[model samples]
Target: MLKIGLIGLGPIGSLHIDNLTSGAVKDAELSCVCDMRKVDNPKIADIPFYSDIDQMIKEGGADAIVIATPSFTHFELAKKCLLAGKNVLVEKPISLCTADAKKLEALAKDCGKICAVMLNQRTTPIYKRIKEMVSSGEIGKVNRVSWNMTNWFRPQIYFDMSAWRGLWKGEAGGVLINQAIHNIDAFAWIFGLPQSLRAWCKFGKYHNIEVEDEVTCYMEYPENMTATFITSSGEHPGSNRFEISGDKAYVVSEDGKLKIHKFVGGSLREFTLDTKYAFGTPETVETVEEFEGKGGQHAEVMNNFVSACLGKSKCDYDASQGVLSLTLANAMLLSSFKNSEIPVPFDDELYAKILAEKQASSELRKEVRKDFILDFKKSFR
Candidate 1:
C-alpha cells in the first residue's frame, strides 16, 4: 500500500482524511496528519497527528504527502515535501503567486517525485466529454466561448469563519481564485490557454472582504476565437452555464446537461458562402446529454495519486498542468489591476511584486472562529 500523510484539518483536508481512512482510495493508507491547530475529529483518532509539518516529515512513514492547507502555505509546504523525497498532491491554485507555483513545479521535477493538484473536475465526465467533443472537431472550429459561473455564492459568515477566507493578503483573491478556480481550470483544460485577456473586478462588492468578489473577463484565443468568463461570490440562485459557439455546432452545458446543436448542410463558413437566399440558415440537429454523479471527485484524484506513487500508472494530472490555470488566473488579476488587456504569459515577477504590495498594505481585520463548523458539501459546485 502507498502510505500517505495529510496536512491541514479544514473541510477539504478532512474530506481527504475520510477518503483515506474509509478505504475509499485503493492501495493507500493514511499514515499521519498535521494541522496548525489540534484536530479533534474522531475519524483520524487512531492516526498519528502532528501540529508541525517538520515533525511529520521527520517521522518519515508517508511515501506521499497531501498538502491541503490554505493557499498561502502551499508553496513552502509543497517545497518541503518534495525536498524530503515525498510525492505531493496540493490543493488548487497551487500558490498565491505564479512565480512560487513555477518554483514548486521545478522543484518537484528536480526531486523526481510526483506533484499533483486537487483539480477533481478534470475527472468529471461532462467536462471530459466536452473536451473530446471540441478537440475531436465534433463542434467544428470554436468561434466563441462564454461561461457564467456565479453559483459559487458565499455569505459574510463564510468569510468570517477564517481569518484568511476572503482577504487579498490571505487568499490572494476571492471568487476567481478561490471559488471559480475549478471552472477556470476546466476552461483552460478544454479550450487551451488564451493569448490575451481584459478583465473588470469589483473588490468587496457583495462581501466585506478586501479581495475581488465579482469579475468579468474577456479572453482572446488563437484562430480568431474568443471567450468570456463571468463570476461572483455575491449572487444567489445564480446560474452556472457554459456555452460555446462553433462553425458547425453550438454547445451549452448547464444544470448537469450538455446540449449540442449541430448544423446540417455544412459549416457556417460554407453555408454563408454558398447560400441561395440571403436570410436562410442551415438545418440543425440537437442532442442533449445529462451526467449523474461527480465522477468520483477528490477520491478519484487521490486514488490516481496513490497509483502513480506505487508505479502502477502515470499521474493523470500533475503540477505542470496545474500551472496553466494559475497563469490564467494571474493574467486576469493583473489585467484588472492594470485596467488593460494582458498577455497570456504576462510578467510573473511583476504580478508577484504587485501582490506583495497589496499584501503589505491590506488593513482588513478578521474574527477568526475556531468553533465554526464546516460544511464541505455546500462548497462543492
Candidate 2:
C-alpha cells in the first residue's frame, strides 16, 4: 500500500483525511498526520501525529506528503517535502508568487517526484463535458466569455479565526487568490490564457481586511476574443454564472444547470410554410444538462492525487497548470494596483518592484500588528 502523510488539519485538510480513510484510496493508507493542533477523532486515533512536519516525515515512514497548509507556506513546505524525496500534493495557488511556483516545478522535475495541485473543479463531470464541447467546435469560434462568481461570502468571524485572513503580505492577494482561484483555473482550462489583462479592484470594501473584496477584470485574447471576470465578497444572494458565446451556439451555466442554445436547420414545416412572424420564429433549440456529485472540490482533488500516486491516472491539476492560473491572478492584481493593462507571461521584475514598494510603505506596514502576527502564527502551529 502507498503510505501517505497529511499536513495541516484545517477544513480542507480534514476533508482530505475523510476521503483518504473513507475508501477513496483502495491501495493507500494514511499512516501519519502532522498538524499543530491535536486531533482527537477516532479515524486518526491509531495513526501517528506530530507537530513537526520534517520529524513526522522521517519517523512516520511515509512515501508521499499532502501539504494542505495556507497558500503563503505552500512553496516552502512543498519544497521541503520534495527535497526529502517524497511526492507532494499542495492546495491551489501553488505559491504566492509565480517565480516560486516555477522554482518548485523545476525542483519536482529534478527530483523525479510527483507534484500536484488541488484544483478539483477540473474533475467535475459538467466542466469536463463543457471543455469537450468547446474543444470539439460545438460552439464554433468563441467570441466572448464571461464569468460572474460573486457568491463567495465569508463573515468577520471567519477572518477573525486567522490573522493572515485578508492581508496582501500574508495571504498574497484577496478574493482572487482565495475564493476566485478555482474559477480562474476553470476559465483557463476552458479557454486558454489571455494575452493581457486590465482590472479594477476595491481594497477593504466591505470587511476591515487589507486585501481586495470586489474586482472586475477584462482579459484580452487573440482574434478579438475577450472575457470579463466579475467577483465580489460583499454581496449577499449572489450568483455564480458563466456564459460563452460563439458563432454557432452559446452555453450558459446558472443555478447548477447548463443550457446550450444551438442554431440548427429550421423545421420542415417552418421552411415549407412561410411564417410572417419575426419575433416568434425560432431558429435555435435549447438543451439543458444536470450534474450531481460530492460538490466539495477538496474531496475530488484528493481522490485524483491518490490515483496519480497509485499510477492509475494522472493528476488533473498538476503544479505547472496551477501556476498559470496563479500567474493570471497576480497579473490582474498588479494591473489593478497600477491602473494599466498588464501583459501576460507576467513581468516578474515589475511585480517584484511593486511588492518591494508595498512592503516599505509605512501606512500599509502598520496593519501587521503584534496581535495580527500572533494570530497568523497560531494557525500555522
Give the number of the best model, judged by lDDT: 1
Q: Against the correct fold, how does model 2 do in TM-score?
A: 0.88
Q: Once superposed on the true structure, which residue ranges of model 2 sit more than 4 Å away at CA?
A: 265-282, 294-296, 356-381
Question: Model 1, clash count?
Answer: 0
Query: Model 1: per-residue lDDT, tens digit, 1-381?
Result: 988999988888888988988889999999999988888899989889998889998894999999888887888889989999999999997888889888988998899999899899888889999999989998999999999998788888888877787887789988888988899899999998998999999999998789999999999999999999999889998999999999989999999999989899649889889988989988989999999988989999898889999999999779888888888888888998999998888999999999999999874554575676667668675
State the weakest 10-residue window (summed lDDT) of model 1: 363-372
Per-candidate TM-scores read 0.97, 0.88
True-structure lDDT of candidate 1 = 0.89
